[model samples]
Every structure is written in C-alpha cells, then in structure tokens.
Target chain A: MKIFIDPPNSLILFDLVERFGHEPLSVMATIQERVDNLEIDMPPMNVTLTDVKNGLKYAGIEVPSGIRGRLAVWGPLIDQAEAAIIMEDAPYSFGCVGCHRTNLLVDFLVRKRKLPTIEIDYPRTEEDARNMVIRVKEFLEGLK
Target chain B: MVRETRLVVISPLSEITPDQITRKVHSLGYEVTVKETCYGAVLEGPPETVSKVMQELRALDPLGIYSKIRGFPLGDPKRCRAQHGSRPGFSQLQTEWQSLSLVEKGLECALRGDKAEDIDIPERIPVKDLQRFCEEVE
Candidate 1:
C-alpha cells in the first residue's frame, strides 16, 4: 500500500512502514523527486498561475493569499497517496509543519479521499508505545 | 518552576547502533530510557540533561543526531489550561500537534535561494518572496 504519511518527514514512521513492507509516501521525497528532475537548465520554476491553482486543488488547501505557494510544493504529495497514517502530537517535529490551516486540510483530504487511515498519538510510555505499535501493525496487516 | 522533558532521537548515519547509543547516553548520568526505534534510540529525560547528552552525541558524530520535544512543557501546570473548572481544554494541549508538522519540508524546497525547483509557484509568489515569508514565520 502506498501509505501517505502526513508530516511525511517522520523518520520513525517512514522506517516502520517500509520495514513492514508497505511503501511510505511523503511530501518531502515527492517534492525532492520533482526538484531533481527539473528540465535540465531553465530557472528553478517556470510555471504559470493556472498550474499552481490546479496544484492547490490537488493539495486541498484553500486560502485567499498563500495557498498557491503551499500548493505548488505539496500538490504532488496528495496525488501519490493511497492510504494515510496521521500521527498526532509527534514528538519533536522541529517546526516541519506549523500551519494549523494545512493541518485541517490534511484531515479534510483524508476524509475526502476516503483513504483507510489510522489516527494516533506519539507514545508517552512503554505501554502506550506497545499499543501504538500493535495498532499500527494491525492497520498495516489489514491493508494486505 | 516547571521542569522540561523531551523525546530525543539519536540518528547515526551508518556508524552506530542503539546499544552503543544506550551506553553513551547511560554514561551521561540522567535517568532516561533509550528505546530501540527504527532509525535510532528515542530517549526521554529532562530537557537540560537531554540537551547536554545530545550535544555530546553530536560531537561524537557531527551530522547524525536528531532530537524531538514531546507533549507538554516538562512540568508546567499552566499547560494543563483547564483552569480546573473554567476552560474545557483544547481538550489536551498536545493532542493534535502532529497535524501541524509538515511545513518545514516545504520551506526547505521553496526557500533554496538559488537551487530551488521543487514546485510550480504561481508567478506572484517567487521563490525569493517565499523565502522571505518563511523567514518571518517564527
């Protein structure tokens, strides 16, 4: 399953999902792939307003001003996801995702896409950790 | 006074193991449990001690260590915010934090000064303009 992990930058979740044999899809890796293949040597970006507008639609972010910028980067991430794992209260995100607006949209998108999702919190204790792993494992296994 | 606690991750490029990390962390003398997670160990402990340990670990391997702050402020009751009977809480301050965790990756691609080419910006939002906007966020 191509599980779309929001915050897709999480090292732990990325590893765990892959270790279990499911492909982990993240916005970072997707964006990196796009940037790496930019048309040989034109400027960094040579896109138009319509292209960005479409990206916003794909990414599910709706704002009057800055949505275009965010959509440009995250649009493809939404395109490639099959399932989702939304980890709440992830320990030490280090400012990777700060906009609550985007957060809500991600939630909205998961619902809109009707993707199978498992919403969880970063564990605070050994028991919590154990249960979290079990829940995640069960969710992944169910995918098969 | 509120004490600080955190969940720290020590990622060693290809040079170390969780056991080695546990040993190194143990030598520091703070009481923490170093759990063996996928990329490395996730150690939980007081903030100051965790910071010192993280610094030492980084010195051992400059670009490999990573640490993360967990839920509430270490020991601050105000973070509780329920006011006992007044407020209904965000229900819990840390409950939905992970949802707000992805913009940094976007910032990285968009704010790349010269070598930036990740997405299709809608003209008005140039990379330089986005970089400036990112700088002002915090």
Candidate 2:
C-alpha cells in the first residue's frame, strides 16, 4: 500500500531505512511527482514523499487541476489519497506542527472524505525520530 | 476562591502528539492547565502545581515552547469589567461575528435547501469591519 509520509527531518529518514528494514524509495516534493511516478511502482509497495512545493515550479509541470499554493491552500489535493502519515514538522520555517489551516482540510478529507490518516508527533530529538520510524515500520509490518 | 483549572496546551497548534505536552508537565509533577490563550490568563492552583508549572516552563526553550496560556486569576468573586471610560473590550466579538455569519449561512442554506458544508466561510475575517457591521445591525 502506497503511503504519503509528510516530510520528517533528514535524520528520521535515515533511521527509517537503516533500522526499520524498509526501502526508502524517494522523497516526495510534490503531489504531481507522485502521480507521474505511481505507475513505475506497482501497488502493495509503499512509496513515501514529503510535501515540498518544488515540483509545482518546474517549467512544464502543469499544476494539478483544482490545487495550488502551500499544501494548506490545496485542500482538494488530499481528497483522493488512500492513506496519509502527517508529520509534525519537517521545516520549521512553516508552523512547527502540521499546518493548522491544512489540518481542518485533513480532518475534512479524513472524516467527510473518508481518507485514512495517522498524525505523527513531532520528534523531540534525533533519537526519538529514529524510534518513531522504527515504530511506524513495525506497525506497518503488522498490517502485512 | 474559585480555582479555575486551565489546560493551556501550547503546541504549534498543528499535528501535536497525544499527551506530549501533558507528559512534559507531568514529568515535573504539575497538573495540566487547560486554556488556549497564551498571555491572557493568570493561573490558579495548589502551590506545588503552580511551582512545578513555572519550573517546567522555565525548562522549555522560549522559542520552541509554542505555549497556550489558559488560566483565571484566583481572587474574590467579582466581575472584572473595564472602567467606564476605558476602551471597549470586544473579548467575545470574534465569536459573536462567527456565530452571526454561521446563522446567515444557515438561513441561506435553509432557503435554498443546500447542505451547510457546501458553503465556505472565509477564515480570515476583518474584525474591525465586523465590529462596525455588528453595530450597524444592532
């Protein structure tokens, strides 16, 4: 099952691959990137991506219809997502925890739109982040 | 004295984990304060709770605390209204306007037989303009 993992700090990603026994495919920059590359990997394998606005600025990358701006501004984008792992903060430049404005959108998508969602807590330290990755991997393994 | 138990949970108000704030407070043996405002409350609790709360607060990095301050001043039972000559305190104005907007939207939805969810209320409303509007309506 493909999962949209929000951007965790770089250290967290390291632990996810090293300790969790999961292959880190690619760090997601934009929603369109995921959509374009979805076919490359078949279903049943998880593909994780961070919510970066980089792809949306490419020369020919057409803005996904009905979505634009910061993820908070693009509430429609998450409507079709199967499941999501929302991290607390990958970039402190934005709000520390997941964006509050977008949270209501996540809630709408989860409760009203019926998307499965798991809100990840912000890691207090590098070690804690690593543990989170381990825990998340263990939880996902249980599902399989 | 009416002891107002407040839980001023100051996370980034984003994707906070369950009990993360409470755990930190409890680690220092302080009960959680329950209020959302950051600077608007004067806390009221047992001396231990108050002391530990301050100590825990001092331990937190000022920049990273993302604190929500919520508490009431423990004192005599008296309504602390602003002086007659002072500037008007529109403490509840925001909620009032929000309620009014929701009502207007509801009425519109009822008349048109549309679902309330379909209507989008602008999250950022101009409070000064709203206060004026409220006065005009009244």
- Which residue pairs does candidate 2 place in steric collision? A1-A44, A28-A49, B6-B33, B6-B34, B7-B33, B7-B34, B7-B35, B8-B33, B8-B35, B10-B68
Q: Tens digit of lDDT per residue, candidate 1, span A60-123?
A: 4446434454455555566667788888776533222545666666667766778888887665
Chain B TM (all candidates): 0.44, 0.30
Whole-model alpha-carbon lDDT for candidate 1 = 0.52
Assess each prediction's global lDDT (C-alpha) against the native: 0.52, 0.36
**Model 1 agreement with the true structure over B43-126: per-residue lDDT tens digits:** 555546665776676566543344343333322343333533311212222332222122222222223322322233256778
Poorest 10 consecutive residues by lDDT, candidate 1 chain A: A40-49
* Clashing residue pairs for model 1: A89-B98, A92-B68, A92-B69, A96-B103, A96-B104, A97-B100, A97-B101, A97-B102, A97-B103
Q: Which candidate has the highest lDDT of all?
A: 1
lDDT score at residue B126, model 2, on the 0-100 scale? 86
Q: Which stretches of candidate 2 lie over 4 Å from their true place?
A: A7-68, A71-77, A89-91, A94-100, A107-116, B1-138
lDDT over C-alpha atoms for residue A69 of model 2: 36
Clashes of each: 9, 10
TM-score of candidate 2 chain A against the true chain A: 0.44
